[model samples]
Target: MPAVKPDLETADAVAKPILIRAGVALIFGLTTVFVQEPSTLWMKVAFALYLVFSGSAMWEYLRREPVPVAMRSPLSMAAAAWMLGTIVLLFLSAPQAIGLTVAAALAVGGVAELVAWFGHRRAFLPARDQLITGLAGLGSGVALALGSHLNPHGQLGIVGGGAIIIGTLLAVSGVGMALDVRKARNLEADRAPGRVD
Candidate 1:
């Protein structure tokens, strides 16, 4: 597969959505971290909101960006997972149900990201970032599923920890990608025809 050349528009398109996602994850992580013992209601509210916001961000990415064919399906499935999870969380107050819903969403989304990365590893720079996020998501999902018998607090901790890790990773990757694209554009312009030393 041919690599997509980085440029100003592409940089902005990718960076903006990624940074938005990072911000969302960080915000959710912080909220969960500060809460001493999150109640079932609190978990439902926070998880629902996070899923809605993050899923919308992913939808916006799909709508605005010219995503590669190999990635479009997986990304769509990930977004759908979030949406369905959001709906389930909104209705379910039991800890086990909530845990299971979250686990399914995270696992599905994580697998989607990994599949996208595997299929298009050579096509874009963000594929590396996707790998990290995928692993984090998958790990979090498995942890949550295993701890489904635990109380709300345990589930909150696992999900919150994962959010923070993924948030930091994406934030760093987005900033680095933007800078790299800018540098590439500058170098290309400098080496253009009729350029003077």
Candidate 2:
């Protein structure tokens, strides 16, 4: 039997959250790229903003949407990690803290996303996008951890670059999901009774 296409409602539910994530990531990435040679204070502020904003977005979505039971924990875990990282940054001002905090947040979020992808591997969610994003976050986190001795600039670059790459991937995934919804609607219309081919 052929695979069934997801209904518009189901696809939209999944796509909206992914698009929100993509927006947050792209904005953070752009900020890092434009801010040249950021001072320790600037990096601290930027990182804090990124974590809180991203976490808030996820938190709001979870409260508003009836996410599947299997997926809810991982998403909530990621949001919690971001919030925790923000709190940690508020107390630590050292340059090294930036790398450590960013690494921890990414690793936690990455693991959560990977878990969600594994659980939903056969479902309607965009598993491929989730897999790639998880990998990117995990890989970047590992790299930052290993480069703990590097200057703040080096640490910022690694995390910022990862954000840009993941943001781009999610942007593409979001657009693809939106297009799929439109195409599915068109196909349904064509197949309806009394409709012209």
> Each prediction's TM-score against the native?
0.86, 0.83
Supply the global lDDT for candidate 1: 0.82
Best by TM-score: 1
lDDT of each: 0.82, 0.78
Determine which window of 10 residues in candidate 2 has minimal summed lDDT: 1-10
lDDT of 2 by residue, 28-83 (tens): 88877787788888888878887787788777656544356778789789889989
Model 1, 43-124: lDDT tens digits are 8888788777878877776765656766878978988998999988877878899998999999898898899889877776
The C-alpha local distance difference test score for the whole of candidate 2 amounts to 0.78
Q: Following a full C-alpha superposition, what root-mean-square deviation does model 1 have from the true structure? A: 3.5
Worst 10 residues of 1 by lDDT: 1-10
